[model samples]
Each structure stands twice: as structure tokens, then as C-alpha cells.
Target: MTEQSEMYVLAIDQGTTSTRAVVVDHDGRIIATGQKEHEQIFPRSGWVEHDAKEIWKNTRTVVGKALVDAEINRHQLAAVGITNQRETAVVWDKSTGEPVYNAIVWQDTRTQKICDELAGEDGPDKYKDRAGLPLATYFAGPKVKWILDNVDGAREKAEAGELLMGTIDTWLLWNLTGGTDGGVHITDVTNASRTLLMNIDTLDWNEDIASDMGIPMSMLPEIRSSSEVYGKGRKRGLLIDTPIAGALGDQHAAMLGQACFEVGMGKNTYGTGNFLLVNTGDKPVHSDNGLLTTVAYKLGDAAPAYALEGSVAVTGSLVQWVRDNLGLITDAPQIEDLATQVDNSGGLFIVPAFSGLFAPHWRSDARGAMVGMTRFHNKSHIARAVLEATAFQSQEVVEAIEADAESVGVELTELKVDGGMVMNETLMQFQADILGVPVVRPEVIETTALGAAYAAGLAVGFWDGIEDIGRNWSEDKRWEPQMDEETRERYLRLWKKAVERTLDWMDDDVEELFR
Candidate 1:
């Protein structure tokens, strides 16, 4: 295919806070895009959910709008790729194609007690080592188990094989393929690795773990590679046969989008929270750093590529807190200018341990803490600190990544970054300064969608090799270290003390504190 006449690929990014659809030309230019925010359900304290139907509705609305905006026929689109929030569990009726329960979001802390109980009971750490994930509430297994135990009649139906269980990717794929008629329930390897269900090496549903959770394997979706033709989609008048060629968890897609093919390279996606992924090559680097070893991607069910992932429970949400809860700003993006107005945080550090510190710090009992707060610590300083906190937490993660990589003789010179937070130049610069390395921002910050699209495009003969992806990558800006050594040390010192104070405060249930 020539550069100009290359086929168009569409990617659906089903995120925690929103749903988006983008049309990318063969040249990697975003021809059209549409985004819609869905309602977040907080039925009980520490429990978070989403209406699966609402998610599908927004997906359809955005896809239609994006296709119209690009003035491209749906038939002309070569394929559709899906990149979604991982570990969010959904159970729906197999016959009616309707969700039986709301989607348990990744951010929900409802299954913490169950996770704690299960992690302590095992003789072997079989779940983590084999699945390439921890037995955390953030993963799907505990949440799936929780619903089966608590939700009325759920376990019975599951036993009788009346229910279908899937991560968001599988649920979305089923809907996109015209529901029950399609009879296509599947998940990509990347998303499957996030659930504490699939074996990392075997890349299939593990019987032992399912028996531990008392979940039936019959309810599970078929696991596939990140790229393949899964099924087709049908709407009112449009019977589109677009190949469902790719599906991946969001951060892994961003890794591919940034073209981080070689080992030791990393990408940080600044989503609602933060996710740092380091390509650990084909071998699963079982982390001693409290990081989750996960599938990077799979090439047509071949041996799966692996990565070490560090998840920060809060990053961008700190700013969202100020806007939605504190009413400091009308919008989150405005926090950048407000934060830059202040020279420093005035000795105040906001440790957003809101959802408990993730990655290396696995303490679920941690709570958000603000220290060294004099009366002079106003909104500007608070804004600066919050933004700085995001960088600091990410720095902690990078430290773990660096320390872990060193054991395997890998060195990180730069970090490839994408996601909504990269749009803030101030935060990007601060992240670079704190890490004391270059933070490279790509021209297409929408790397998540692009990653999915590229995978799909590659699967169907649109491209010849991964080198084509690397050649398409171009930097919009590269941020180098700017802060002095003394300032870095002082900031780090304060954050350490602040973190010391936050732990164990959550020893009790978070629902009580939330109330």
C-alpha cells in the first residue's frame, strides 16, 4: 500500500472515566475522534461500578459520530481494534445478552478483605507466579468471587452455566458482534493476564485458581491473542463486516503505540490513575519489586511477550478531586496554569494515598495525607503539590523499575509517555525533573487507541513489520531534567515522611472513613 492510499483503522478506547473512538489514517494521522464521559456508580462506600449498557451506548454513539466526522463509510474501515480498562469484571446472560450485574471497576476497593484473606491462605503463591498478577482486589478474581458470594442467585446460575464472565474487552466485543447472534465471547491475552484467572505461561484458564475462587471455568470467555479477526458487527441498516482484529488492556496498547519493542524500554500512561509498564522481553520477569508481571501482547497465540507493570491508584484523580470535590477549579486541565502560578508547594506535600499506594507499596491500609500544611498553603500551592505528587509517585515507580531492571542488567535512559496527563506541559516537565531523565512525549498522545489500531492493521496485511510502527513514531517534545539536585532531595524527603504517616490508617474498612 502507498502512503496516501493506506487503509484506515478504527480503535475503540473504553476507559474508566470515558469511552472514545478514533479513526486513524495509514499515516498515523487521527482523521476523526469522539469522546464521551459515562456515569460512575458509587452505590456503596469503597465500591465502584459502571452500567455495561451505558458503556455500550456511548461506544455506539461515538463510533457513529467519528465515522460521520471523517466522512468515511463504515465498510471502508479495514478493521476495529478494542483497548479497554483491564480487570473490570462483567457477568451477563448468555441467552438474552444482557448484563446481570454492573461492571466492577478496577478502582473499586470492595474486594480488599477477600483478597487479603485469599493471599494469606495459600501454601504456594501459585496464583501470582502462574497468572503474572497478584491476588489483589484490583484484579478480577476477587471481584468475581465477591459477586458470586454476595449477589443473589449469581453462584447458582454460574454453576448451571447460565452466565458468561468477561473483562470489558470481551463484553464490548460481544456487543459489537450483535449480541447473542454473534455468540462470540473472547478476551485478548493482555487483558486475561490482569485477571487472576489465566496462567501466564500456559495462557489459558487455570483450573486450580478457579477452584480456589469457586468460579466455574464454563462461564469464562475464550482467550485469544491481541491481534486476530474475532468476529463481525451488525447495526440497524449497516451490516458492517469490519474485522475485529485487535484487543488489549489500555496500558499495553500504549506500550505498542509508543513502539517500545526492545526489552528495558518503558512507557508511562497518565490516565485517571497512572500505569508504568516496562518491556521485559519474552520471558516473564517475575517481580521482586511488588510489580505485577503481565503479558505485553501476543502475536497470533504464539509465546506471549511479557512486561512488569506498576499501577498507581491515583495520579490525575488528585486534580479531579480538586475540581469535583474541592471546587478549586471548573476543569482539571485548568489546574496546570493555576499550579504554575505558585513557585512551590510551600513545604506542603499532598500524598494522594486515596485508593492506597499501588505497585511497590502494596499497603491497602494507606490513606491520603497532606503534611507541613501551614495556613499559607493555599489552592495554588495545593495545586502545585498535587501535580508534584503525581510525579513523585511515578518517580517511586520508576525507582522500582530501575532497581528491578538492574538485577537483569537493563538501564533506562528515557521514558516514553502518553495519556491525558501528558497534555499538561507543567506536569510533564516536573515528571522529567523528578525522574532526572528525559520524558519523551509523542506527537500522537492518543497512543492507546493508536496501539490497538496498529495491532489490527498489522494483523491484516496493512503493514509488513514492527519497524513500520517505529518509523511512524515522532516526538512532539522531549523534557530533560531541570531541577537542581538539592531541590530533588528535599522534595523526596518530604514525600517519604508524608507516606510514613498515611499507612495503616486504613487498617479498618475504608467504607467507614468514606462515610
Candidate 2:
């Protein structure tokens, strides 16, 4: 046996915009990392796609690069865990292992019409009780249906059991486990819950939902616990022979990575989208608020735990738009300095409903808007408003969470945050000020990858238990509320007004553009 100190866990974080591989040691510290960005395909105004082949190739390259950077080989690795952007759907040939169409991203709103059709007279809330998610284009089921209905011969292939379907995690897993040779097609409870086909209580695919969607059950992956030895890496590049031990949707993994084991403890992850999830213990708490109830994580043979998640469709991606589309900034990080140049936004407010508002307001008709822009406002002011937009959106979700938690007799006092955008101290302070709660950041901001590694480590005995992983968490910084209550209220009022303007932008004309 390799010495405990010598063994490491490799976590693959397949996200919406990029694929990252991180190698973590026994102490839950990242030893080395490698990342690759993939193209974001937009077939039309509201449609999004990704080349599954590119993502898989990038995953292998990043994993090999990360291992080489860490000066480690397959022998020193205890296991591999996967954390991915939840709800991105992929359908592929079972025998050949080739994707039938481009992967439909979670942010793609191409299925709004399909979701509307599913809602029917009963409305979007019809599926809320059964699936713990409202009928929105921001899920996997409708995306899967879109592929089957639109892609020629896909429905026939799926019904004939010649094809397999899964989210990004399952796609990576199948390829890593030897694709055509003997790939295991499975997804964790966390990812399955986002599909809108899985029953929250049973933790299995709901036959009624599947039948209603006209989806063949044969195409769905086998549901599994989050932490267990799913299979061994077979033909995967440098990962061959390593145990594939853990699987989690990215947000669930972040919650675990933050050590939010107890109920009411939560963490907010800022990636392509922003998600705030609070551990709701073992039993699922159906939300009266717009937040979606989901599986936090399920270990081997244990009952599944639940979480209430407030998902924002856009946050960090808004920054990317400013850098890419607008060209106001040369790089994403440059926005921080530019925004800092101005003490305030100069009456500008950016409502980034790029993919529609998620959580609290699941309005698919909404569109991005910039209101209250004055002629005197400069690019710095626009940048400030752009950064402030994330904080303001987070405040909306936090308020909704507080309302829901209070209804259930749980009071959330603070927030634990992680993700790439958390590195911006200015935004962190603004978030704290807006929420009027202390925002705490961990010593390691790569919690998404670390969370996956921790799960794999536990399954393979690299770490004894959750307590060992908890001890690895240490606070690096804390931001307290500084703005006066009056000022905060004034800013929030303006934000609400701006959000109202973004709504109903997806009218007949816009809908026609999508088709």
C-alpha cells in the first residue's frame, strides 16, 4: 500500500465554460491544477450547445496535465471524483460512444416552449411537488426531449435502446471507464435531481414523468449514491487503474467542500451561474419560495440528504459578457480595478437576466437590461454596476432563503462563499454590505474541486470521515456589513425597478428569432 501521505485524490470539475482538474492531498489542499476552456456554441439567440467530443478531450488533457504538474502517477492516486455543471444533457451511441448532438447547456433557454407545453393548464408548478423543481428550461429533462425531438433519428435510436443519455458527469465517467469497452453509465443523486425526471423522495427516475416526456427509460443512466466506488479508470489517459469513487453536481460538491454538514449551513458558489444552497438535513423541505429543493449529497448506503437551492442564472458570466461582447474591459479581473476607480455606479444599474432570472423569479420571458444609465456615466460606472449586479442578485436569493428558512423555524445568520469570482475582495465586501451578513471565505477558494476530492477520499479511505475533512477547512477572510441600512434599502429599491424592466422582453418578435 502507498503511504497515506503519498496518495492523492484527483477531482475533475467539468463546468459550463471550462474543464478543470485539481489534485488534492490528504489534507484537502490542492497540490496542482490544470484547466482548459471550451467554445460556447450558440446556434441561435437563446440556444446553446457544446461539442461533447471537445469536452471529453479537454477533460483527458487537463487530468493528465494536472497529474504531471503534481509529479504524481496513477500509482499515487487513491481515487477520482467528478463534479460538473448540473443539468447539461448529452445523448450518445451506446456502442460507438459518440454524441448524437451537441450537449444542451443548462443556461440554454431553447426549451422554453417545451417547458411551457409541459406546464399546460396546470402551470409550471405542477411538477414542483414531484420533482422539487419548477418547470423551467434550466433543467435536463426538457433539454433531453429537445434533442430527441429535433435531432433526426435520435428518438428512434433512443427508443430502440441503441443510445444512452446523461449529464456531463456521466459522459466523462463513461469515457473515463473505457467508453466502448465497458463504460458504466451512471449519475449521482445530486445530478439526477436536476433532471426533473428523478423523484426527490425515492431518489429514482419517476416513470410517470419519463412517460409524459416520451423519453425512453432505457436511455437514462443508473442512479447512484454520491460517494462509492462506481468503477475503475480503464482506458482514460493517466487515470487508468484509479478508482472512480465520487460523483456530485458542482453546487452540491461546493456545499460539502465548505463543510456545511449541519442543517441551515449553506454556501454560495459563483461560477457560470450563481447558486446558494443550504443543507436541509435528511428530509426534503418543499419550498414555498421559488428556490428548488435538491439532494445535497448521499454517501454509500446512507439516506440521501436534501438542500434548498436558490439558483441565479447569471453572475460571473455577466462579467464574461462585459469582457467578451462589450469589450469594455480587456480581461475579467480588470473589471475590479475599473469599478474601483469610481466610488459608486453613478446611477447605472445592470440587470443581467441574460438567460432569464432564476430562483425567486423564474421568469423565462425576462431579458438583460441596463437602466438608470446617465449620459455622464463612463465605462467605470458601467463596470461598477456590473460588479454590483452580482451582489444585488445574491441579495435577492438570500432574502428568499431567509423567508423560506424562517417559515421552517431556521434563521440563517451568515454565508460561506467559494468560487472564482469570490477572489474579488471588492465584490465580497459589497455582497456582505448588501446582505447585512458576514461573508466568510475559506482558505481554499477551489471548494468545488476540493468537495469532489473529499468525497472520493472518504470512499477510498484516504480520509477517515467527514470530521477529518471538516478539520481541513479554515477561514481565510471575513467581510462584515458596512453600508448603512438606509443606503442599502435605496440601492435594493433601484435594483428591483431595474429588474422589472428586464421582464417581458421575450415577446412574439424575440420568440420568433429563437425559432
Give the winner by TM-score. Answer: 2
lDDT of 1: 0.86
- Look at candidate 1 and give me any clashing residue pairs: none
Report every candidate's CA lDDT.
0.86, 0.92
Per-residue lDDT tens digits of candidate 2, residues 1-515? 87888989999999999999999998889999999999999988878899999999999899989989999999999999999999999999999988999999999998988999999999998788889999999999999999999999999999999999999999998999989999999999999999999999989999999987889999999999999999999863687788999999999999889999988889999877789998889998988878998999998888888999999988999999999999998888999999999999988999989889998899999999999877799999999998899999989988888888765456778889999999999999999999999999999999999999988988988898889989999999999999999999999999999999998888888676656
Q: Which ten residues in a row have the lowest lDDT in candidate 2?
A: 403-412
Give me the candidate number with maximum lDDT: 2
TM-score of 2: 0.99
Root-mean-square deviation (CA) per prediction: 1.9, 1.0
**What are the per-residue Cα lDDT tens digits for candidate 1 across 465-507?**
6888899899999999999989888888888888999998865
